[model samples]
Target: MSNRVDELEGQVAELRAAVNGLTEELVETKDRLRKLEAEAASEAEPPAERETKSDDHVVVVEQEQDDVDVATDSLGSDTASEAEPGEAAVEPEETTENDTNKSTDDIIVA
Candidate 1:
């Protein structure tokens, strides 16, 4: 019974070591694969085939405004929820974009 227990423990240790080595190899393989894929993608596309956009162009992604507020709240604000007795409440900036250039005729692909 004692010999059987010792043999089982040794097998377990060997199995664990093998798993660790395989995990490390798997991680290395994934890293290599990503690098190869990125290189292949770059090589496949020619410079002239890519569409370039102007730096001044602003991409306005239309989505639910409520989700934006929730995301911002989750990230937290610079101001403390309740300031020290003597400290003043820090007001966040509220700059609104002028819709002078905004248009409904927007195309994602264009």
Candidate 2:
């Protein structure tokens, strides 16, 4: 009877240690979650404020036209040859049954 009691006590001790370890891990996880939520809250702005701030900011981006042409040409797409430097390629409009009924006056020129 004493041997059985000793074995049960050993198992209880192991269980206690496992429960303690799990509790510590859970606490650490909760702390990490709270920190992350706080950081996210600090960084986020209200929608109205964000929109107003975005309107006040102007972003300009510049890239060389030659670099674009080189990348396109390397990809083996015939786009580079279709248009000359400083010119845009004009595509011919396809004539469909619906399009044929539309008058030329209805088309707007840019």
Candidate 3:
């Protein structure tokens, strides 16, 4: 009976050691998973889309009214005649430095 009790006690000790080892491994694994998830979330967003602030400074986007054309030409221009109500006007970008002689009627094939 004593020998049988000793054997049972040894088995219980082995089981307790195994459970402790498995618990430590589980905790370590959970920590590693949390770190990996944080890294993935940070990488998913670009620098422009992320909300960020530095030293009490925040970034702001400003739209200048001077860049947009709100009034139509009264001199019978094609842009003014062809524009529809409730539609935004589009201004052509200057592509060349020597555009002094270029007309609005010129077709840019590129």
Candidate 4:
């Protein structure tokens, strides 16, 4: 009976030590998980902040497109005004008098 009690006590002490070790490991693992989560959060930027940056980029692109369109329109108007008025005129083939009066040199001028 005495030997059996001693064996049982030894087993109980070993089990208690194992439970303590498991509890300590669990606490450490939880701390590590918390630290990892915090690091991940610090590295990440919020979606709304990223969207604001993208919105700024979109505005800049739109402004550039508007400037380019304005510049092209002004350039086209300037070139059109610079063109000679007589050269800008388009006549139909049915305008018989002008076609007949045209010199051969002028007909092939283009």
Candidate 5:
């Protein structure tokens, strides 16, 4: 009976060691997986992604400003037309078309 108990105890100890080793291996695998995922995410974001994101923001800002200008122009026109006599009503035109021209004149000294 004592020998049987000793044998059972030995089996339990072996199982515990195996379980500990397996737990350690699982943890290491999970850490490696997390590192791989992070690397993949970083690699997936190319320079073009950043440029597209910046262009999107610029477009959104330009659209919002255009909307505001349209609103203000409409309001001004309404007020101007409602004004009493003797005022010369002038319609606003695109005066500075050159202002929108992007010239790559600045040389980068590197």
Candidate 6:
């Protein structure tokens, strides 16, 4: 029948439109991936083009490290002087065998 033939043609047209939409999305995604790869390549520095710090830079770093060590040593002595004479460090009480047996003997849930 002509009616059935026309219905089939309409379905075919919808399938073609769907395929075209998906094809366009695939092309755009591929283009975006290529651009990202190119950008990453440009940002990378090759080994031959790498720069090194001079002797002055090394000396400056050593002086900074010495300053840090002196500051930490001063801080350590301050903490040692701050401990109170009355406050002793508390240690946990040692568990007895009877106490362990009593605890594990019963479990109460409320």
Candidate 4 lDDT score at position 29: 100
For model 1, the superposed segments whose C-alpha errors exceed 4 Å read 46-110
Question: lDDT of each structure?
Answer: 0.73, 0.78, 0.73, 0.78, 0.77, 0.84
List the pairs of residues colliding in candidate 4: none
The per-prediction tally of clashing pairs is 0, 0, 0, 0, 0, 0
Which candidate gets the maximum lDDT versus the true structure? 6
lDDT of 4: 0.78
Candidate 2, 1-110: lDDT as tens digits:
99999999999999999999999999999999999999999998733212223344764444466766777778766766666798866899899877776776588899
Candidate 6 structure quality by residue, lDDT tens digits, 1-110: 99999999999999999999999999999999999999999998644233445675563223355567888999999987998888898999999999999998898777
**Whole-model lDDT, candidate 6?**
0.84
CA displacement after TM-score superposition, residue 20 of candidate 2 (Å): 0.8
Candidate 5 structure quality by residue, lDDT tens digits, 51-96: 2245644632233555678889999999987998887769978656
RMSD of 1: 21.2
Question: Once superposed on the true structure, which residue ranges of model 6 sit more than 4 Å away at CA?
Answer: 47-110
Q: lDDT per residue, candidate 1, 16-92, as tens digits?
A: 99999999999999999999999998888543233445456854444466777877886675345544668766897
lDDT of 4 by residue, 1-110 (tens): 99999999999999999999999999999999999999999998744212223564463223345567888999999999899877856776566666668754366643
lDDT at 66 for candidate 4? 59
Worst 10 residues of 6 by lDDT: 56-65
Q: How accurate is candidate 3 locally (lDDT)?
A: 0.73
TM-score of each: 0.41, 0.41, 0.42, 0.42, 0.42, 0.39
Candidate 6, pairs of clashing residues: none
**Candidate 2 local Cα displacement, residue 58, angstroms:** 38
